[model samples]
Target: MESNEPLYVIPERYRKIENLHIVFWLLKDLCWVMLWRPLGLVMIVPTIGAAALITWQTRHIKSELLHNIAVFFWIIANAYWMITEFFTTDDSLRYYAVIPFSIGIVAIAYYYIGLRFAIKK
Candidate 1:
């Protein structure tokens, strides 16, 4: 981490516990996606790597970090829904994914807006 960055540190022992929470949530979403969408297999490895990142970044950081993590999973879940719908019903449910995806985008905007304008210098 940069020495001058606004960093938060978690207790060393709690890190493992916090990471477990991240893994459980990430794997749950990924497995659900994998069950319905074959294309999800392509992301298995990358998702695990990303889960680690989510865990690390979210451990002791502000709520904004958790918001970002939620955004990622929301997008992943939407992609899974879209991919499965594409393979199963020929794009019949593709439009339904717009809801969660839109929500994810909004969450991202909020997170950034908070970071840029809400925090004091």
Candidate 2:
């Protein structure tokens, strides 16, 4: 048997980090919807669909800078939501929700910074 193959291939410089960042943001957004929706898990289907599209489109990209910027905005939005939730005095459930909401904001900021570094290279 004989086989023929291309002698060389160049691996993409930004593939791994970009993909991971996209996945993290998508998951966090899904978590947000799940946490806020009245139906809980039922809201995850639309989140999953959006994630699939984002993953598919970003899988081959070599630039993550824009994605990082997007993540930063997402964190800011989440932080605002959490702060509002924390201030609500009517329900204990709203008070308890602030914990996870704040945690999600922190996670978004962390990943956004990481992705920024990844794009800098």
Indicate which candidate wins on lDDT.
1
Predicted candidate 2 versus true structure: per-residue lDDT over 18-83, tens digit per residue = 465456556655655555543323333443444344445554543332444344444444534533
| Error of model 2, residue 66, in angstroms | 6.6
Give the least accurate 10-residue stretch of model 1, judged by summed lDDT: 36-45
* Alpha-carbon lDDT of model 2: 0.48
Predicted candidate 1 versus true structure: per-residue lDDT over 1-121, tens digit per residue: 4587766666676566556646655664665555734435554445545554664667566564657565565756555674665467666566676676676667667667765577754
- Alpha-carbon RMSD of each model: 6.8, 11.7
Please give the CA lDDT of all the candidate structures.
0.59, 0.48
Assess the local accuracy of residue 121 in candidate 1 as a C-alpha lDDT between 0 and 100. Answer: 45
Question: Quick one: how many clashes does candidate 2 have?
Answer: 0
Q: What is the TM-score of candidate 2?
A: 0.30
